[model samples]
Target: MNTFLFSLKVMGIGLIGIFSVTVVLIIAMVILTRLFPVSAEKQDEESK
Candidate 1:
């Protein structure tokens, strides 16, 4: 029972760490996209 509880604790910590990192990365991407938006010309060319 002790070992099971320890394993669960470790897994929970690991999951939380992964979720935090993913959220940070997503936020960074959103900021970067806003700071460097695509040009109208580029959009037009891609549409063709």
Candidate 2:
């Protein structure tokens, strides 16, 4: 029972770390996209 509880605690901590990193990455992506807006003309040219 003690080992099981320890494993659960580790898993919970790992999940929280992963979630925090994911949130940071999403925010960074949003900021970057706003700084460098994409042009429709560029997209059309690339689709050729």
Candidate 3:
């Protein structure tokens, strides 16, 4: 039982770390995109 509980704690910590890193990366990407957004004209030219 003790070992199981410890394993659960470790798993939970890993999950939290993964979730936090993912959230941070998503936020960073959003900020970066906002700071340097693509123009509609550029997209239209690329589509041609």
Q: Please give each candidate's TM-score.
A: 0.69, 0.70, 0.67
Candidate 2: deviation at residue 26, Å?
Answer: 0.4
Provide the RMSD of all predictions against the true structure, rounded to 1 decimal: 4.0, 4.1, 3.8
lDDT of 2: 0.92
Sorting all predicted structures by lDDT, with the top scorer first, yields 1, 3, 2
Provide the global lDDT of candidate 3 against the true structure: 0.92
Candidate 2 lDDT over residue span 1-48, tens digit each: 999999999999999999999999999999988876688557878999
The residue pairs found clashing in candidate 3 are none
Clashes of 2: 0
Write down the worst ten-residue block by lDDT for model 1: 35-44
lDDT of 1 by residue, 1-47 (tens): 99999999999999999999999999999998887678855887899
Scored by Cα lDDT, where does model 1 land? 0.92
Q: Poorest 10 consecutive residues of model 3 by lDDT?
A: 35-44
Better of 2 and 3 by TM-score: 2
